[model samples]
Target: MKNTTISDLKIIQIDKIKEERGTLSVIEKDVVPFQLKRVYYLYDVPSDAYRGGHAHKELYQFLIPVSGSFDVILNDGYNTKTITLNKPDKGLLIVPGIWRELENFSSGSVCLVLASEVYDEDDYIRDFELFKTLKTT
Candidate 1:
């Protein structure tokens, strides 16, 4: 397999609509490169707590911090990059075959994730070494 880098990642701007009721941010299905299969959010994360210590083999995920802020550390078994997500209308697209970890979550941070696939244990590469191997070939 060819190596992937941070350059392959994308920052997607979610459309925000302001109304008398409240601000609305949306993740439209056709707006993204991939179709949405699963949607999950992380909330009530403590300052020291961390999430996402694995990489997906065939799944893609777009992460957005709907509230507060956090850093998404991405590694492709070669180079590493960190992208911060603090806005509800901004998303970080994490491609497959890239090792990712979410850290430095601020108080009351809510991270919303849009996935390309549903829950499948076999699609995940949880070990760093295995991810590295898979990233190379």
Candidate 2:
């Protein structure tokens, strides 16, 4: 985790196929760096609400805005970055050991999360202070 920085965060462009009917986007195993183990989404969130105020120990997540848009605030315990997800054909790849906060959600926005691991409470570092302390050591 010492070498992991904000630069490790990547904006992955999903493959989009356009035809006469409509556009289709595909996300297969080759597109993502890790093998997907779980999938979920967030919807009907209030505009002022915030989510994901924690950092994962081993889980890697790929976040996609399936509908509408939202902002993802990422902190690597040293630097911070705020990225907006507005397109369905692009996704943000969040590596492990990075604190993430989801906010500024537009109306009717849907945030799709693809996880590399299953739900594990022990893998989460929920306190910012603790995360910072751990990153320094």
Model 2 residue 20 lDDT score: 97
Task: Name every residue pair that clashes in candidate 1.
Answer: none
- Which residue pairs collide, candidate 2? none
Please provide, for model 2 over 29-89, each residue's C-alpha lDDT reduced to its tens digit, 9 standing for 90 to 100: 6788999999999999999999999999899999999999999999998899999999999
* Candidate 2 RMSD computed on C-alpha atoms after optimal superposition onto the true structure: 1.0
Please report, as a residue range, the 10-residue window in candidate 1 with the lowest summed lDDT.
Answer: 1-10
- C-alpha lDDT of candidate 2 relative to the true structure: 0.95
For candidate 1, what is the TM-score?
Answer: 0.92
Alpha-carbon shift of residue 115 in model 1 (angstroms): 0.6
Please list the residue runs of candidate 1 whose C-alpha ends up more than 4 Å from where it truly belongs after superposition: 1-3, 19-21
TM-score of each: 0.92, 0.97
